[model samples]
Target: MTRPHTLLLAATLLSLAACNDAAPSTADAGSLAATITDAAAATDVVTPADAALAPDDVPAPERFSYVPMGCTHRVSAPVGSTSNFRDDRSTFGAAPDPHDVHVNWPADPSSTIAFLWRTDPGTRATVVQYGLSPTALDQTAVGSVGTAGLMGNQVTAHEVHVCGLRPDTTYHYRVGGEGHWSAVQRFKTGPAPGRTDYDVRFVVAGDSRDDVSRWRQLQERAMGGMNPPDFEIFTGDAVLVGFLQGQWQSWFEGARSAMSTVPFVMVHGNHEGLSVNYLMQFAQPQSGVSSQDELYFSLDYGPVHLVVLNDTPLRSDYEGDVLGTQLAWLRADLARARANRARVPFIIATHHKPAFASSSHSDEIDTQAVRRGWAPVYDEFGVDLVLNGHEHDFELSKEVDGQGREVSGRRGTRYVVTGGAGASLTTLGAGALQPWGAHFESAHHIVEVHATMTRLELTPRRLDGTVIEAGRISLTPRAP
Candidate 1:
């Protein structure tokens, strides 16, 4: 049996040294490169700058690009801690006080904050009032409401985007429409984009389907920990059934502790079938990557340009290629990122399907399809890291190229599978390790990514507080 500590050491070494999988590594094959080249030549790619002129006669890619709305924090007397951190669990389901209060950055994180909440269907309106001081929350923001959940048990979903706020400052606010409002909560804005000298921390994990209690614990611990993450990133599978209103409620209830103060950057998983419920729920930045809903998009948080992809087959139930329109848009996005690498030096791509996993579902057709269609794009663009979920276990891969070859130095993409968040574990079968599999853990936990301009540090911690794997990748550049 591989003890947790030993597993952690092995994974860390493999990541830092850019190790390979169990199979014999090979160089980039000629055919795959040629295929990518041909695709590029054949497609009329759209750049971010030119995306706006997309003709209405033809379907233009849906995208939302953000520019920094710089602001200085108002150093008002800090609102008392009780007004900010008290648990609102007791007030849940009581009335218009709202349930499932969550935050996201659908617009500029520096000057805008997006919120989603649930209220009784009878509630007349959904609104948010926020400001620099708790007592003087005179500013008002109205939100739209929609119906969610299965037939006969629908709930009202409300979302708001509070614009024109200060950057890197704390603000107090409450949710509810008209006469009803919940307790005031606080959230801090992140640093402006293109600022690369500071440190950024974010929690990355997924597959919390059907395990609400465990998910609650993870949320409490993650938010309660010292210097909690700037935001939360779930690769996907937030709920067992994407269309189930009750499951969505359960997920929001479990995660409300952290989410109220931190924004959630979400992705779609196989479990998010049809994405009807998902589309109605949280609002994310539009990236023009997908003709579909918020299933695929991109956002810039500080210096990191994070691309969220919808790799699930649109017609089927989460089985297919990332080819066609999404791939072409992705290539264009990466090209833009590479051209402006100096401004945003770290570019990380995230999707719900894994390129490699040593679990029972490792060989799923969708995973293989994603590898075939998207891995070459990742390699060609020099994507720094690729994050994924879907497999119900933790597996971190070595820095492997499109052909599974171990690339040395600071090159190659590092892929990590962090699907252990509150999901049932998947034990590795004997001799099931692939050449790309560097570390595998069959436990429920979360992965913490500490990002700086020149380095990215990874630490996967079990729910019980055991550090299972730790590694660091340097983004340092060589002298000319």
Candidate 2:
């Protein structure tokens, strides 16, 4: 039987297709439409009103159906442009020297780690040497290489995966081929899956566009702490222009110190636009959505489940109903996370746009659209926190339900905008403090989260180490 929400979506899509002459062809819609249809057919029907409720209230899946009105193409460079970075050997050395090295967990965070780096086009070997001790680097992992055209410069990206690692253990590794190798860097693997006894710490920051110096300072501060982060959740906009090779080079150079050891879980920001640079630089877990795998993904670390969503969709090759497709995947993802609440007690969602913020982007169409579409799902799943960026300021919302109303105690999700990593600050607008706003600040800062099985303590700190109203949330494990 066809669900009411599915009928609404089909009607909406048909209406948009008929009225909007600029809409992409049905062929361009790809399998996403079918994926949504399949997802909807498997679930019970519910209205938007039925999904919004307090924590103790019965939960229902959110009904969100919206086709993008007019998908605007945002890629700055011409599509299908080939890279020419190797063409200029005088500027770029002929040797297969590697740079811009970083690490990510594309598989199990406890047992696997993927190393990504860039070398000259001439490089043929993609290898990583590692061991339990830096002195005895005995093991080797071989991987494949690919090419990307960034700002007219063609460079090779190498990805090597090292697995069979021990949980909560430290290992030293280096990436490169032959004579051009990077210095040995060390990283600690995550705790065993479903292990809630171990504590975890991570940093959340974003919007470092056009300010490399400030970003360098922020990275230094984040890594210089007595208890450095296990990893970083970057809210996106790593460069002023995502497609520009020089900007990315600068961004990576600034972060080389921290990124070499601490892996980054990135979100796609608007400044990244529709550039391939964003996709080429980092390796993310597959979202099982065919070609849209890298657009959104989720991972489990210690006692927390981190869901990363892509709310920034511009004109691109695979741009049909992005939010809708993500909504379907998100429902299933959160459902699984909810079922495993006994092991992972917290669900933290991160994305580029803020659903609740008092800054410049508060009233933007995309912000409101995300709020309308995803909030109810978050409320239904009892998401503990939603961290966001793109506002260029810091704002924390009181615990609120899907209807944007404050709920008693810990009955609703807390929305936080932590977009002040290194971007130019934007002041809160007049009357910016809404009833749901708990605090607002326009300073360069990063949010530190300390998570345990029973509690999560979050602190937003300035560059000078000043804490901005630390908040804590206590949790009781749900039935498995």
Per residue, candidate 2 scores C-alpha lDDT tens digits across 1-480 of 234334334423432221112233354244325434444543332222112211335543321111111211111112222232211212233867778889988767887787888877666577788999999989877665555542233446667666678999999988875667788999889999978589899999898876788788889988998999999999977765454456788889989769999989999776665354566667777665433446688889998999998876533212343457788888999999999888898899998888887776677667777888888899999898999988787888888998789996577889989888787788876656877788888889888889989888788888787888643334444334
Stretches off by above 4 angstroms in model 1 are 1-95, 288-291, 317-321, 470-480
Q: After best superposition, candidate 2 residue 86: deviation in angstroms?
A: 18
Give the best candidate by lDDT.
2
Residue lDDT tens for model 1, 12-57: 2332121112111132123223323443432232221122223446
User: What's the lDDT for all of these models?
Assistant: 0.66, 0.70
TM-score of each: 0.77, 0.79
Candidate 1's TM-score reads 0.77
Top-TM-score structure, candidate number: 2
In model 2, the Cα lDDT at residue 8 comes to 32
Alpha carbon deviation, residue 477, candidate 2 (Å): 5.9
**Where does the lowest 10-residue lDDT sum fall in candidate 2?**
68-77
